[model samples]
Target: MTPNTARRNEASRRAVLTAAFDLLQEVDYAKLSIEGIAARAGVGKQTIYRWWPSKGAVLFDAFLMLSEGAGGEPPMLPDTGDLEADLVLVLRATVDELNDPRFEPPMRALSTEIAHDPELAAAYAERLDGPLREAKRQRLRSAQQAGQLAQGLDLEVAVDMIWGPVLNRWLQRTGPLTTEYTDLVVTTALNGLRPRGSSS
Candidate 1:
């Protein structure tokens, strides 16, 4: 495509994603329609259909676009040589995002899709979860190297142990997702995850 044509296409794509995200904020998921999105975006419905197969796909891209901002990457977990402090920082940020009204509906929608839609679930695994989970595992590896965590600990389980509580609480709505709760959770998890002493 020509440079002008490419720029126009990029603009339209961003506009469509923005419109879908904004509509999800204002309307029920069931009420969101391609026609409405196209109208809001000032693009033809065919333009949306040409690029995406279904409303779910558009919603997925919109969620990704917003979550990634302009970077085309998920935000990285910080590693400051202090695993507990780093995890607490990451978890507290997660709490903030979960508590945000702007992120809630789309996150809810994506969670539903992840539970039932195999294709979207795989896409999420490959595109979003995979990178993020790897980052967590890498940080855990650093802690192990530093003698801060168990030498033979299973990274996956370690990851779950560190993060599972808050995610469970958020999804089940069993408790408040507060910074205080995340702080306590991080401290408690670190206590359990500390390097076990060698036995005779």
Candidate 2:
């Protein structure tokens, strides 16, 4: 495509994703339609259809875009050489995100889609979850190298152990998904991950 056409296509894509997210905040997902999204985005219905296969896909892309929260490179969690502090920062931020009105609706929506749609769940793993998990594990690896964690500890399980409780509470609504809750999770999980005799 020509440069102008490429830019226009990208602009339209951004508009559609943004519109999809905004509409979910205003209306229930059942009321959200491809036609409505197209109208809100100021693009033709075919334009949205050309880019995304379904309403869920548009919403999925929208969720991803917003979760990223910025452009250029994927941002990494702060590595201050203090593993406990870094983990608490990350999990507490997750608490804030799960509590966000702007994000909750789409998060619930995406969770629903993934549960029912295996293909979408697979794509979510590949596109969003995989990269984020890798980054988290990278942080954990750094801690291990610095002797913050047990040398034989499995980072994969460590990642899940650290973040899993927060996700379960958020998804199941079993309890408060608060910073205090996540703070406790980090403290508890880190206690296990820390090397013997290493002060947390």
Candidate 3:
């Protein structure tokens, strides 16, 4: 493709993503349609179909884009050699992101839709959960190698335990999502993972 063509394509893609994200905040997922997205994006319906198969697919990509940090940096789990500190940092950031106005509504919409749609849930897991889980798994592995975590520990379970409380609270709206809560969760989880007889 020529340089100008590539730029135009990129611009169109960005416009579509932005429109989908904004529309999610304005309309319920059940009410959000591909035609609406195309209209809001100032592109034809065929343009959206040329890129994604369905509105769910478009919304999924938009969610992933928003999760990317400012300037489009990929979402990351920090590894600072201190497992507890790293987990705390990551979870605290998660709490903030969950509370952010731009993310909260879209995420709530996606969560609601995913609860009833297996295919969309699978897509969300593949596109968003996969990377986040892998990042946490890698961090746990590093901790194990450094003797910070107990040997033979199930890293997957460890990742879930660390995140379970925070997610539960977010979804249930049962409690405030504070940094202090995240710090406590991280500390409790790390305490369990630490080598036997080692005090955290």
How does each model score on lDDT? Answer: 0.86, 0.87, 0.84
What does candidate 2 score in Cα RMSD to the true structure? 2.9
lDDT of 2 by residue, 10-105 (tens): 899999999998988999887889999999999999998888888889988986776677674665889998888888888888888889999888
Candidate 1: the clashing residue pairs are none
RMSD of 3: 3.4
Model 2, which residues run further than 4 Å from truth? 67-69, 193-200
How does model 2 score by TM-score?
Answer: 0.87
How many steric clashes does model 1 contain?
A: 0
Number of the top candidate by lDDT? 2
Better of 2 and 3 by TM-score: 2
Candidate 2, which ten residues in sequence have the lowest lDDT sum? Answer: 191-200
lDDT of 1 by residue, 30-109 (tens): 78899999999999999999999887888888877765885776556788898888988899889999989998887777
Order the candidate numbers by lDDT, best to worst: 2, 1, 3
Which residue runs does candidate 1 get wrong by more than 4 Å? 67-75, 193-200
Cand. 1 Cα-lDDT: 0.86
What TM-score do all the candidates reach, one by one?
A: 0.86, 0.87, 0.80
User: Order of candidates by TM-score, top first?
Assistant: 2, 1, 3
